[model samples]
Target: MDAEQSIADEPEVTEKRGLFGRNKLATSEPKPAKTLGPLKMIWAELAKYPGKVALAFIALVITAAATLAIPAGFKLIIDNGFAAGGNPDDIGRWFRYLLMIVGVLAVGTALRFYFVSWLGERVVADIRLKVQDNLLRLAPGFYEENSPSEISSRMTADTSLIEQVVGTTVSVALRNILMGIGGTIFLFWLAPGLTVGLVIAIPLIILPIMYFSRRVRNISRSSQDRVADVGSMVSETLGAMKVVQAFNQESREKTRFEGAVEAIFDTAKKRILLRALMTSIIILFIFGSITLIMWRGALGVSTGEISGGTIFAFVVTGGLVAGAFGALTEVYGDLLRGAGAASRLNELLKAKPSIAPPERPQTLPLPPRGSLSFRNVTFRYPTRLETAALKDFNLEVEPGETVAIVGPSGGGKSTIFQLVERFYDPQAGTIRIDGVPLASADPAEIRKRIALVPQDGVLFSSNARDNLRYGNWDASDEDIWEAARAANAESFLRDLPDGLDTYLGESGTRLSGGQQQRIAIARALLRDSPILLLDEATSALDAESEQLVQQALDNLMQNRTTLVIAHRLATVRSADRIVVLEKGQIVEQGTHRELAAANGLYSRLAALQFTSSDAA
Candidate 1:
């Protein structure tokens, strides 16, 4: 066997593996999330805590009532304290009434704060959990169009906005609305003529409010999108920092990040400027109308059309109404912003993954024997529908047999593994395992019968034991060590200070490429599925490590149906049958000796490898 019989005769396997590995598992599009009005969705979330919501509303009502009663208390203090027959006891009793109302106001305000704040925190937590769970269940195809960074931003920034609206802003708006209505009623009773003067300027205030409401909503939505863009840039750049530095692209990344930040600033500036202009207009109209109305009330008191106390009560009550009206504008802006956040979260929750179990899914065959067949399978990635990844491909594998698929890049090698795993249903074909068509079986049931080790060794930021246990969550410690030993990974795992408890950093950065691949193989071994799919499993390993892992693979493949996607000819020489694929079709297939004797594509590739090895 020539040394160059490996794919090292061509470009490195690692480089080719990267290109072929992408877009392999393209699932069907998920069900579109329902587009619900933001307020309606928020109400549904709040409805989950009916008792708390009731208590909060009751507290809010009491607080508003207390504020309204204060103006009445002032009237009593003025009228009774200085009555024509002015009894000393009566004056003292009126003061006592005022003090009692204040006490009620204090308790109600505190209760309102506690209940609303608690509700806000609780509701936001529930929303975040729902979004997270739904995201996990969504098809991987969703990530092709949407960035993880943007999704994360919605979970953090958008949820925070919802919390503020739910906790404090909602109660504040309701209270102000109550105050405005109560104050208006009292104003008309106290001095009807002056009340009429204040109502006339309502049109002036309403016009500006309408203008700001539309602009704030549109601008706020854009502002949020811009912020998410900034988050996406930061996440993408940081995750790829190694590549960025290796290519000396730090300055370019910084410039890209700065552009994202400036986009956010520009959007925010428009929103803030509109809010400021609206606030200025509201203040001018509210206090301007109050000044003119109160001047007439003072004149009425001098002429005897109204008493001195009545004039004071009218002016004070009118001031309360104007202040409440002003606050309503601010509250309206908050509600708008919160709506945008709620709308985003609702969309995420409503999305249903395409690969979810049918309403009445068929049960898979019991005691899997690992036989699989593909009849005229044709497929294209959901994201790349124009380009066919596999076209009318046909194959069959017997139980306990090992079949190696050898092909150039993008020859449907990885696509076969994806179809076997049922990540993406072929556009046209009948794929069966144990004589049962895949469409007739539940997706989860199909996956349980198969184990996969792709080109990359996917590892999470978790301990060694936890990562290994991911293959079979209920597996025992003894079983875990057994699988690791079988994969030739037991020695390195034993060397670590914490043994199985050693924390694997993000993506197993603590381990070398060969070590990570070994761990991946160990994970698959722990699954102990009836069928196994290995895609370039040893393509990245050094010579010494490859020899050891290859031996482990041989042991694991015993008595199991195995399909190998190999770039290196030397690795698959022992396979029971070899299939040469080109342009998504099987071009030639035979054992190593048969293909070499035929002097076909396989012979040419083998000759290149041997000649390259001889030159070295």
Candidate 2:
């Protein structure tokens, strides 16, 4: 590609970073106190519907309290009910209270689940919206540094992790913490000796759990990044499916996609093994220590050191505390994953677009008479900063004048349009529209006066009416029909099954190349902008279609500033002036006859095309 020398910058600045693998942290690593601050961003979202959060918290408290109270009823059943008398009335009364506590626990648990789940959904939605809104406004330079697919993965995959943390993990961890604390206190009251033994075993149980937990967090983050890479690959391939199929590379794409899937599986397997190991260790320590304590309590009961009912209470509550602690290990893992997700989303929200409106931008004069000028401008694309796309380029088009630019490939013809549009700012010099520097004016306002018909004839996957109306949002049906007729597109468009309402399909695939080109012309015609840019606009049309479109172009150029780029010498022969370029410098300019008489670049280009036997 000749353009590579002009388009390629120094290799883009590369950051060696993991995908879903960002914000690395080991589970056993001591979390900084400030690690909670990022969570505050999530809390701010949770604060939005305070009523729902409050209701959920209240329900969680009720559920935890009810669960803790169940062991008390067990104490009554074993102590008083199993006494020598063993009264049926007392046992029945205690059973009734126990059933009541179970019922309360069931109701509170249901409510808590509902409220937190809803918050999870709502907060994720809010964060996604904020990220998307910010993304839409960022400068094009931002995209040059970031792949769109990765940005998309952040919006979806990252937010989903945040959702799990918010809706499920946080609620579970808080509830279990309450249960563990309450149960521990009851255990000491019921059997002090067993409590002492249980407390002594806790640190031993926790140590391994924390160690494996850090390993799981790291593995989980890596797995997420691999899955996102799969997403990016899919996006990249599908967007270029035509090229892939054209080259008969279907098997290659399939193999590539499968490799990504395998990468995700490999990472996930590591995480699963670590998590399973952690669970096994914690469970073994918990029940193993509990069993030893139970044996000692049995001896105490037989010796009358502790009552049978009291020993039972100690056993049950100790199990409850142990279970909660085990669950806490898993909850902590999820919180770290959620924090990683939140941090990614925060990065997007904090990005500021390189191109932004000036704080007090000068408003362009209304009813703009499009007069465009580029003065001593030099530019290099951000990705290819080492190569200048255009250097010291100078040109000016007066209002209502028509100019045709002819050049070899890489002569910076297209770069001219980009600079005028301010898609990028040049490294030096200035661009002005109607005597006002674009830097002092809003890009949107500058663009409103110019209309472009790019080489590809881009269109949305929408009905004909919508695609055409995109040129001028407020166009009336009559105005649209008039524009269509002027572009020589009204006949074929009317002949379609649904006329204006026909669905164009993606990139107008349902239409012929000539038809799509005409539709594009109609759209540009409808814009009725004061300045027009035609980049190989009629290149796709047949000879007959070209004649009609050219006639249409003549009308469109009337009393308008027109800049035309074309390979066909016939198209620009009648322009008010033709400018020939070589290596980003103007080599010649004049009327066709004037340039042809010079026997220079324009004459040579004409010799290749205009004098060909099959030339139109």
Candidate 3:
């Protein structure tokens, strides 16, 4: 089965490589080691919108400056405007000036938010598009080793975290840094001795907080992981509800979900407790230092060593500095999280497709003859390197010829289709379409001449029209109807509520297994490719549906080159030639009557199948 189908069938907790190559629970967020270097990718994206970035930066500076000016404005109102002999006009002027600064602060802060948020959303949108584009270029082998579920989570959860970093965290960090620096300078100007004392106390306050914050962060990560665990369990249980009910295991499932929820609650409780302790410690240190500073300032006021306005400004600015630094402590952790997200996203963005067009690709011959040849091909799937799927296999099919490949389960019947599509290059072979080597031509060009009907019909979540037209996007409604009629899908297609416009639902769940297979056949008919591949195309259909579809396929195969993989020996009786594969090698090849008479492997398989059919 494909990776996506496997993940859907069994939604178990798996492990994926973390940011630094260590395996971790897939549900947990990736953690970055010591550096935020991956943020450079975000910067690269941000650089695309220079005007918006510049505007945000300018507004950020204005807001920070306005914030610092507030304390100075208050000091002027107190020392000059509120003095004993001050005129009412002087008081009014200072108050108006302070109000003006507030106006600028409000406008600048709004502008900063708007511009920063725009840049964040734009950058994320671009990254997602680029990542998806690269993902499309990747070969199927990549999906074999990586879970689509984990990759999907990175695409969504990781990108959303990046959006937060761009929109909120980075802006807050920059603004707070400016405020912290500006506030500290102002504090020193107001009272040098007091500023030195505050600076010394700053480390003592921050060091303990930092240590506590580290513990809190770790607990918070664990808490989030537990919540993710709960979410995964809920999804798994709901997805398999039918199986659970059939097995009378609803009570077991309930207990399992309850256990998951309690685990989440327990982790949350620890995080909350740590955060509460941290908050209490922060309050004691911050307020205690403020009290000491206030007492010293009070003595200075009594001795007339400094004015009331100066001490007041000093105290206010000191609070602003402390708050700024505290906000900064949280910023680093957020940046680290963003860095982890960026690293994972970068991995996707930077991935080079293993199967790609060469620098100079050879164009396939015009007016395709659909002739395909496998010359001494030896191939192995990347995941199974030790076992060759095809060992020195050779085959040649001319235009307008039908070749049926009959095989047991692991006999390399499907590998031929994969090689013909150029999804992977064989380890030792030259596969050619119309005399053009696959490796020398673009994969798109190679696949354009081929059509495939898989054992299971795969459909997208869309209207029937779209699903049918997927094989040939430009096919007209009339063309689609003709193909549907040929595939015996016209009656069912017209019976739907909205006809062609009815939503097919995910994977065409609205259609029956036989109906879905017919739709798949109709799609291939619409493709009008010269080379057709049918991998148990009628496997899901009933006897009648199979017979009708087989007649349609026979008509379609008359002029096209066809390769059929059929386990039902009866289906290949009319083929020009039948090749029976065993363990990656063709053990016998002949007409049905000839092979059956020879009493070889093909004869044995045919005897067993025919006997089973007779018994039924």
Candidate 4:
């Protein structure tokens, strides 16, 4: 046969087949995660874990309490032991006070670490679960808009970043604020005159904090995006490894991945350096202020205006004030960075799905016989609104009738299938099964009576039996085998080493195209619905395999209202009627012989394939 004829021909006999010939099924795109909100959403999530959050607050309070005690203990030791002519009993008393401070700090630090770590892990787990549940509720269109890696990044990297902010940053910021305030108050109380010079250092500290914090926030978000890009690249490449290797594109793929990694590293390095430099600057300011104050205190001690112990105590308290300021600066920067990331994540969590089921759905009465009527149905795909996918389409299929839909590519054949599945509602017009409007029906209930075998015959990463069981989850082994037999797949399946237990690798990659198609057919058979829809089900199979599957399909179609989107003329010829679609309109429709006699669109299609077959 010539090229087109050879492509269109199908035999009418059955045959045995081997596996290992199918292209992997197309993986669905990831859904766009909600955008993050500034800080409100982050706090909202924390509110979800109240008990743990309370524990976290308590730990923070204890940590701050212990931290404030350290400065007071040092002040007492210096003032009591070295100044005022040094008393033996007073020295022992100061040593005891210092030991108590160490003990309290050690315990508080341990508890704070434990609770924060626990909060981090728990929050991450909860966020992942929440995202997964939301994904399940979303319409299929969500996946079409995003990539798998993008979804995974939101579930993993984005949540982890938020976790770091929530579990550690918030606690540290609280502790530092308390310390910064308490340290300032004590410095004023202990050495009222020196506190003025310490207060002047505030403007110096605020400048660096504001500049570095803004930079940290921007760089943190950029770093997250770079990491997500790297993840997306890895996930897409590995998922389609077979295609990459088949085209011998390994070297090109490597270069692409390397570029992604380099971009991530470049961004990450900048973020790290900025954070380190900010910390260094804060540390320098803190110590620099303490050094200046100590010089003034030393002069007082030499003149005996301030005793030796008083000078020592004043210097030590001043150092604590500096340390607290440094911690506050670092913690504040962290808060800003986390707030930016939280803002993005909140955008995703807050989004409402475009397709939501009605709060009170109408109940549809089941028809005695499945009869579908498409009454002036019009639809436009979400992505392409300029051109109508289906415009005022009308069709009526009676129970036990087999109608074939024949058209060129993009002529709205798949759009009809999408409507039947309720994947998208018609923009205009009403479609009813058994006189009950689809829009008025409980969508889940309406779908239960229909079965579909799509062109791709996509399978999951599972065993043969589990894949078949997907159609009817509670099905027994006997039921599964019966469905396989109906699809002409049982014989081949029985020959596998483990029979029904054979593990089909990702997307049934181990099976041939024909074998996967049969498995899809088997799944449809298991559903055993009153209405069946087949979208080029056997188009990809070899002639030998197509004939066997066609026979199986004939048996399966018996007494069912069947809608077929046909690619091959032979299949269309056997239909009770053929509906010719052109540019989303059913321009012509009749029995194959009647349409051929009229020499319309059907006649032209037949002549193209027939003349080519004759020439071959």
Return the TM-score for each candidate structure: 0.78, 0.79, 0.89, 0.76
Query: For residues 389-430, could you state the per-residue lDDT of candidate 3 as single tens digits?
Result: 999898889897888998788999998888888888999989
Model 2: lDDT equals 0.80
Ranking of all predicted structures according to lDDT, beginning with the best and ending with the worst:
3, 2, 1, 4
Give the runs in model 3 whose Cα sits over 4 Å from its true position: 1-23, 84-88, 220-276, 610-616
Candidate 4 local lDDT, residue 28 = 18
lDDT winner, 2 or 3: 3
Of 1 and 3, the candidate ahead on lDDT is 3
The regions of model 2 sitting more than 4 angstroms off are 1-37, 80-89, 209-283, 307-309, 488-509, 540-558, 603-616
In model 3, the number of clashes is 0
Per-model CA lDDT versus the true structure:
0.79, 0.80, 0.85, 0.75
Per-residue lDDT, model 3, residue 504, is: 91
Error of 4 at 264 (Å): 14
Backbone clashes under 3 angstroms, per model: 0, 3, 0, 16
Q: lDDT by residue for model 2 over 1-616, one digit each (tens)?
A: 1111211211122233333334333221122232545677799999899999999999999999998888888888778877738788988888898899999999999999999999999999999999989988786667766666667767887788788888998999998999999888888887777888888887777777667766675666567567668878999999999999999999999998998999888987887677777778877987888788878988998999998888877877777787788678767756875786787678899988766778888888777888988899898877777878788888888888889998788888888888787778889999999988988888888778888888777889999999888889789989889988988888988988998999989979998777777777788888889989989878777888778778777777788898999876666876888888877778899888888889898788777867654232
Clashing pairs in 2: 9-384, 20-225, 27-214
Question: What RMSD does each model have against the real structure?
Answer: 11.0, 8.6, 5.7, 11.9
Top model number, lDDT: 3
Most accurate candidate by TM-score: 3
Better of 2 and 4 by TM-score: 2
Task: Encode model 4's per-residue lDDT on 251-341: one tens digit a residue.
Answer: 9999998988898789878867887887789778866876787788888777766655555556665565655666666565456656655
